[model samples]
Each structure stands twice: as C-alpha cells, then as structure tokens.
Target: MKKITIGICSIGSGVGQSVVDSCKFFREKVSLIGLGNNPLAYGAFDCDKYAIIPSYYDDQYIIEIEKIIKKHEIQILIPGHDDEALLLAKNHEKLTNIGVKVLSSPYELVLICRHKSTYAENFHEAANYFVKTYKAIDIKDEFFPLIAKPEQGFASKGIEIITTRDDLEKIEFEPGYIYQEIAVPRGQDPSYNAFIKQLRKGNNLQVSEISLQLLFDRNSDLVEHCATYNTLKGGVPIEIQPYTTTELSGFIKAITSSLKRLKAFGPINIQGRITDHGFKAFEINPRFTGITGLRAKLGFNEVEFCIFTLIYSIKIKKLKLSNKYLGIRQVASKKVLQSRVISIKKEDSVQKNILLTGSTGMIGSYLLKQLSDQGHSVSRLYTQEKELIDNKKGYSITDLKSGKINLSNFDTIVHLGFARPNSTDSEIHSSIVNSFELATQAAQSAVDQFIFISSQSVYGFTSNGKFTEDCKTNPQNNYARAKVTVEDHIKSITKLSNETRFTVLRLASVIAPFDSNLSHEAYSSMIVSLLKNKTITLSTPNRLISKIDFHDAVDAIDHFTNYSSSSVYEVVNIAPNKNFSLLETMKTVAQELGKTEDMILTESIENEEPNNLVISAEKAEQQYDWKSKTSLNKTAKYFKKHLGY
Candidate 1:
C-alpha cells in the first residue's frame, strides 16, 4: 500500500492534541509535518518523520511548510487548531492545486462556523420555536455585567462579561460581537439559572446541546471542564449531562426533527434560555466548540464527523452512542470528586430491545431456550430457513445494506453469526457486519443490552501461561479482527445508565453432540487414517486445549442478567477445566461409546511447545452467580444418540 503523507497544524493556544494523537494512532507510515511554534514543547506530535513551522503569520510559515510538504510529497493536511484551520480554509484551493488536501470545509462555511456573533444573530432569527430571542446587546449597555465575546477567533481567546463601564474600557470594541443579557439567579447556588440549549432552525432540532460556561463579569476566563461548582445554580461543564430518562426520548426526537430543516456545514453550539414562553435561543457558537469533544464521546466523535463532512459533505449521525449503558470514566484529577457510582432507579426488564443473531445455531438455539425460560422476548437473525419449524421462528438472512430489518422491535441484540476461516473474507466481513448492523439497528429500538457470541479466536496462543479476561490478545487471523470490531462499536455506542450492556462470550472450541469438531461426530477422519496404518501426528505434546460443552456456553449467556456496567467482558473463554491431550480426549469418548482402539489413531505431532489459553472465569462465577456444571465426558454421552459411531 502507498504511504499516506500528512501535515499537522495546531492553532496558537490549546491545540487539539487529543484529536491529533488519535489520528496518529491509526495512520502509520505517515509523513507528519507540524505547523506552529513550540508544537514539540506540547509533546503531542509523535510521527515517524516530522518538522515544525513557526506562527501562522511568520515569514517561515510558507518556506518551512513547503519544504517539508515537497520533501515528503504530502497529500493530506489536518489542522489541530481553529486558527490554523481558518488560514487553511482561505487558501484551500491554492493548497489543493499544489497537491495538498485541506481537511476542512469552504472559506464561507468556515467563517459561518467561527463567528460567534453570526451564530447568535442567525440563531436569533432561525430559532423561533426551540430558542428565544437572541439580541446583540450593546457592549456599553446599561445592562449590569453583560456576557460578551468576539464574533470570531479561536477557542476561549477573547471572552468576558461586562459588569461595569470600567471593565468594558479594558477590552477593545470590535465589530460583529455579542453583549448578551446575563442570566440572574434568585438562589446563592451557582447553577441557580442553569439552562440547556436545543438549537431549532425552522423546527428541525438535531440535538439539545447543553454547555455550562462560567460567568465572571466580562468573559473572565474560559474554564475547559467544570462549567461551575454549584452546577445546579449555573451549569455543569460535563459533556451530555444525564437528562431525566422520562423526558429524554421525546426531547431527542424533537431535536432530531428540528435540525433536519436547518442544513449546516460546520459545528454549531446553541445557547438555550427556557423563558416564560419556551426554550428561547440565546447564543450560538458558529464553529466546532469545545462541546464537540463532550458530545463526541456519546459515540458521535464529532471531530471525526466534521472531517468527513468538511471533505465529503456527508452528514453522519455521530455513531449513535448511548448514555444508557453503564459508563465509568476515570481521569487523573487533583480535586477528588465523589467516586463514580451506578445505581439503577428502574428495574430493567428482560429481553427488551433484543437482537439475537445465530438465533438458529446450536448455542443460539440453546440461548433462546434460556432467554424464553427467563421471560425474555428475543428477536433472531438466522442463516438459513431449513424446515417448517423455522417459519414460526422468523428465519431471516436480511440484507444489511438496504437496512431491511427482520425484527428490530427489540431491546437487546444477541449477535452470533460470524463467518469462519473456511468462508471467504467478504463472507466473513458480511456475517460480522450483518450481525452487528442488525444489532446496531436494534439498538436504535431503545435496546439496553448487546450480547455477541465471540469465540476465543483472539487468543491465538497464550504463552505467558494462563490467561485472564485482562490478558492481552494476539489474534492471528481475520476472525479475531471481526469480533474486536463489533465489540468496539458496541462500547462506543452503549451509554452509561441506559441499562444497555455489551457482553461478549469468547467461548472456547465448543463441542456438542452435533458439532463438526465433536470428539465423536467426525471421528471417521482419524479413523480412516488409523485403519490404513497411517502415522498420526500430534504437535502439541504436553499442551492443553481449552474445551467447553454446549450446555456450559448456554449457561454463560444466561449470566448476562447481572452484567456489570464498568466491566467490558471482551473475552469470556467459555471453556471447561482440565486440558486433555488428543489421545486422552479420544479415549475418554471411546470408552463411553464402547469403541475399540482400532477405530482411533492417536497422532502425536511431537513437542512444538504449543501455546494454549486457559482464562480465569472468576468474575463470571462471582458476579453472575454462574459456574459450569457439565463435564466434557458427561456431555460426550449425548454422542451415543446423535453421532452414528
């Protein structure tokens, strides 16, 4: 594959280090050239090849940048700061002609986004139903302590509140600025006049965005995080504050309908004032505000979203993250806030918002039994409809691209369809994406839990001895990658307190009475070879194979009821204890089936020092009150009836 060249630019202050770092994590073999002085000092850039240019207006800006770009034949340029983005937008076409790509929208769009005054003015006119009147009050108005900000410029640069004429004189008066009426509070609490804004442009309200900006007469200081101490009095700077669950669905639905009309090109932050009439629009931040960072974690990733929109004009619903799923974010802080806690107010019902793939598969069929037994209603996605019985069960292999859903009126989606290595790549990708896409669509149905049946294919071999859920994974092939993709998407979308859970059962090689790998089901392969006096090779001498019976797998699925919000159970190796050798395993089955040794060939492939996995299911047992009760030998007895040995 050809190497992708990149130029990284940060604005003057408080660059988007996190966004840049995240980009760097995915883009390898990137020729990363930096634009800005002291960028290295911030310790954000860690590219394979890099150079630094001075300030945006510095003489060396063109000289140094061009040199690095030409040297590396740079193709894509991603800005880390708003100011750098502004400059690049103006010269966007010029850069494009010079074989450089600016990942931003047009100049006019950039202006519309950057100008804070324009947002307030435009929203004042546009926000008739959702927002109240937005007036650009005079900077020198008689209004005591007016909230004021420059119409344009970067993040938190020239923001202040005007309490007196003296405070106004300290700041320079500029055109296209807003002097808004400050919200007064009756109580002494800081969040007394707390407000949440839902930007409504002609009725299409996409989201009810709430930002808690601190007020000190004359836009004192822009605190990045905590908007206020007594957040009830003012507003909390927390991203996507947990709204009352009762009002959430209706509120979000209203916002979604409102924003569909106001087609916008860039980031928009609307100030909401719920007056005597209704939600009155106060101000609008035209550009991608810091709130973009907050809302993105709700699974939207707006930074990523804007990049695509700016380049391709594609409007992506930020990857549909949920606050309903349990989320615990631990940040290093000197101020010790109260420790995080998850206390569910309402009792979560079983099988609400359910999407269960492999609904027809062996383990899936068994899981269906337990789910039904527990009074949980489930929706299934089956691979094939073989018999008359499947008709009543809603057998479906729906088309994912067209979004033709089978049964998405579900609350929990249990995905079990994954293409194996024997299947082609497209087939594998299709099955994985289909399973997830089905679940993703089901999550749209207010589903709370997304349970996927993933194999322990991720742990190709556990060499550092025994493995736990926390052990690092080293997937050797496509199967592990597919499972990881689904898991990642689930976590990103599932929110805290949605009662939405993402549980993966990283089962061991499961063998039932019907499995192809069953010790008895396909013994003919080794039996024929043994009858021909062929030497049987066993490479994993003195090594262990993690094993699980079908019943044990079903038990694990039943255990998701008491799922933890904090723990992301990625790999629940649903394996039984005791790793028997190929010879020992065959013998165990043979004695039960009353088969002779002549029917089996114990191939010893010699000591390759095989790497095997044995996971600690301590958490599963402790938290879910679950334990594997069936032994491999006992389960193998079912082969007597099913397998024609």
Candidate 2:
C-alpha cells in the first residue's frame, strides 16, 4: 500500500467539501489536507487536519502545497476542483516528488480543454466521428429541463437549471459555460445508449456505474437528491442511465477510440444522468475524484492506476477489475513502492504464449509486464528457472552459461538484453557484444519470432531528416558497428531456413525514472543547477536526438514480439517523432524546473559540433501498430522533482 498526500485545494466549494468527506477513502490511502479558509466544507468526510491556504490563485499555493506533500510523505494529490485538476496536470511530476501524485491530464491537454468555447470546438472536431455532432452546446434546445454548466467549472459551482433564460441569468451568464441537453426524466429516453455503449467496451477498461447526487441547501436544511436512477427500484444510483453490459461494451470502445488520439493515460470522469431511455453525459473530467474510487471498488480502479503511472512509475497496461467487490475505500498507505509479480499468471487460451530474453534487465522486466497485461502467458528465460522452478525472474548468469537454459516453449521472443551502441570505450563495447552473443544463443533455441533491442545510434551519425528502418547504416563507432554486425549475423541465420524469424528494434536513448540513465541524469543535473543557483556546462552542442520513456521503449519491444512477429526480417526504430538538440533539451529542462533559462549555456557545448540524429517509427507502426506515447515534455518532468530545482 502506498501512502498518499491528497490536498483538497478549495474546500469552500461543494466539490472541495466532498473531498473532505472523501477522506473516508483517503483515511489511510491518502492524508487529507484542506487548503482553503472554509470550515463550512466537508459535507461528509473528516481529516486529521486542514491547512488553510491564502487563496486558489495565491503564488504561495504551490509553496504551501509542496510543504504538505513533504510533511505527509504523500504520493498523490486528489484535487477537488477543476482548477486544481488543471494545476495538478501542469505540475504533476513536481508534486509527484515529495510523494505526491496529482490527478490530472498532461498540461498540454488541459490547456486545450480548460477553455469551454475552444474545447467545445475542438471536442467536436476530435470526437466528432464517434459523437457525430456539430457543436455540443448547439444541441441544447433538442432536449431540456436541461442543465447548464461552466465549461471549466466544478462541483456545480457555476451550474444552472435552465427552465428559461431568466434562470441562466442567475449564474451571471459566463461565456465558457454551455447549456447541455438533459436526459429525459428516468423513464423517457432510449437514444442515450448510443453513447453509453461506446464507453463500456475497451481492452481491460471498466465503465463506471455513474451516480449523480445533487444537493440543495434550500432555506437551511440540506437535502440530497438523486435523479438519474432515482426512478429505478433496485438499480445503482447513477448519472449515466444503465445499459446492459453487452450493449455498453461497444460504447466504451468508441469513446476510448476517440480518446486514444489524446493519448490519455490517467483518470477520466464522465458525469452522466440517467434518462428515461438510457443516459446522458453532462461533463467530462480528466482527473480523479471520489467517484472514481467508487467505480474502482465496484470493478475499476482508475484511482490506483492514476497514482501507479504518474507517481510510482508503474505502467498500467489496462484496467484490472477485482470481482471481489471489495470496495476501494481510500486509506493513506505507508509504502511508497510495492511490487506484485504474478508468478503463475495464466492468459486466455486464444492468445499465444510469447518468449522474452534478458528477462532480468530493467527493460526486460517491464516488457514482461506489458505482455502479461496484454493477455499473454509471459514465461521468462531464466537460467535459474529450473533451480527455482517456481520463480523465473531473479536468476543467475552463471546458471545460463552452464547449459541449463531452455527456450523451446514459446511463440515469440524479445531479445532485450542491454547493449551499448553509443559507448566510446572499446572494453564496454566488447562486454555488450558478449551479452548480445549469449542472449542471441538463448533466443535462437526457443524463439519462433525473435526481436532484439538494438540502439538507434547503430544508424550512425547523419543529418538526414530522420533515420528510418531503411536509413543507411554507417556505424562509425565500435558499439554501433558491433550491433550492425549482430543484426547482419541474425539476418543470415534467419535466411538460412531457421525456424525462428527475427526483428531488430533500433531504440532511441531511453529516459528512465531514475537518474541512472544518462538522459535523466542530464536533465537532473540541470534541475540541480537551478535549485543551487549554479550554472552548468555541456558538450553535445548541436546534436538533435529523439528519446523514449524507458517504459515505452520496453513496451515497443513487447509489441514487436506479440504483434509484429509476422512482419519480420526488418529493423525498426522506437523513438518519438519530436527531436530536440542537446542544448535545447537541457534548457527546456531548466524551464520546467521553474528556473531562469539563461542558467544553461549552449555556447560551452557549441564547440563539440554534435551530430544530428532522429529516428522514425513509421515501419514499426505499420507493422506492429506501435508508437511511443510519452512525449518529450512529460519525460523531462519525471526527474524534475527529484532535484527539486
């Protein structure tokens, strides 16, 4: 269990107040801290204590929140309002350090979604295919006794019940708010299934049993009212009208298909009201809330997934449901990191069993998780699997050399042993070459479709627009040359009627969460400099490079093994399309750390005359439907809080 620090930023508002009540979930799962002046909040939850911040816009909000994050040793901040959600996304990794995982989208998405008018336009464009709508707000007249809300407001803050134009005037008529057509009263509509069906069908995804409770403080006494499913006798109270599981599956798939383009990797809350025929969605939340935890308890754990990915560096392949109905009651956990390796995870009989080499390396470890999550029986190639019989992950290389390893039991193989194609040192190259030689032998025995993790540097230094799989190989360095040698060797073996096919994945420099990787260390160095108010020097002056998040890179290897095994005998590059010069990347690192950009100097590195290199993944996408999702900006921030610059 991971202990979390969750600060409710605007407890004065109803949504903020619910957060305090939500501490029932946060009691131990997350430490609840209030950041507003209102004691009138917390309609249902309780907390150990609350810290009243000056204001939401106060510059000191970040300063004080940072303090609470450190004090509680928290790993996640579950904001109560939309504003805080925006703030969380912008400062995810910043808050991520000091044990804070803020629930929000990537800042880029937030910027595009925060403005209602703009979002309405873009949402139509982005989701128009599934929704087939011209503009969401324009459809308000089609259905009424409807609700109207601020495009970016939260907790019914600027929400209005529009019986007429006069009611809209009560909320001061904001430009960002949009009047949405409401669902027909619980017994009157059927078309709602169109949207609900799309959302329930997805890979490892669980659609929420949406429940909307509206509170009215009429006169003095507060009353709770449920409208969506209030008319149903035994159905769960819901905002989205309930549909049969079979029907909603298609709905979930359609929506996610649209969201896939957005590259969503966090919690997304949709507010729906049950209509007479089905359900109507009123709003979309790109962050976590107590409701998400409710859905988690029922079947989906989006809350856990959110913290797992953004803060703990856990890559979520798909939503896992715990049918135990063991409700996810939030309790601040004590452990910051926890590992659960499925020793005997069984996949569906339909999915093929795949083989992965270098089963103990960091990249390999992650790749196994990817395959296992994708409904594949992932058996590790451990030299000591026979000795431990039960355990396949932690093994000894000595055992492998003793001829104890066997590989004749799987469908695909991922050769992911670490190889240094960029090392300037000859000894390191020889050692890396040795690892590859040994790994290939292990793979060749059992792998039907073998994939090797080769580095992008093997393409050689060049100024081509980008290096594709077809890029000319000019391995000037020993490391690159050695890789080229092995790729050629493997091709020859495959062509000679070997049962096993092979793929060589040329990977970009990967940025892992830890500073152990050079890219992260470089970024960390800049953050440290910014915090210490020191200047740093660099040498890779003008070299343009592409990078992959370590997890994403590993996932690409998995994709090759499972999906692209048929498209074999080809080399592929695993890298983001965006390329940044070494100096430019370092400066961006500085800017993200809230530092003066001038602190990092390109002049000191300009003399190095670095080579320009970027790799394209068109071939990989064409063959495996695989592409990198962790963008440059997101990768840079993973280490931002570590140095706290």
Each prediction's Cα lDDT score? Answer: 0.50, 0.53
Candidate 2 accuracy as lDDT: 0.53
User: TM-score winner among the candidates?
Assistant: 1
TM-score of every model versus the real structure? 0.46, 0.41
lDDT of residue 334 for candidate 2: 16
Give residue 339's lDDT in candidate 2 (0 to 100). 12
lDDT (tens digit, per residue) of candidate 2 on 1-645 = 544556666655545543444334323344455556553333212343455555546777777778766775555566666766677678777776656556555676666555544533555433422211223335444343445666666544544555544554554345665655444324333334443343233111122334432211212111211212222212222233222333234334444444445555455545554444444444556654544434433434444444554446566444434344333333331110001111234333336566555665557767777778878887655433453465645434454566565655556656565444444576456545545555466345635567777778787777648887765788767777777777777765543222355678888877665444544335444545555778876656577877677768877776666553322255678887577777777677667656777776655553565577688878777756788887656655655644453
Clash count for each candidate, listed in order shown: 57, 39
Lowest-lDDT window of 10 residues in candidate 2?
333-342
- Model 1, 14-105: lDDT tens per residue? 33433443333223223344445663333222333335566777765665666667776877776666666677777877788888876655
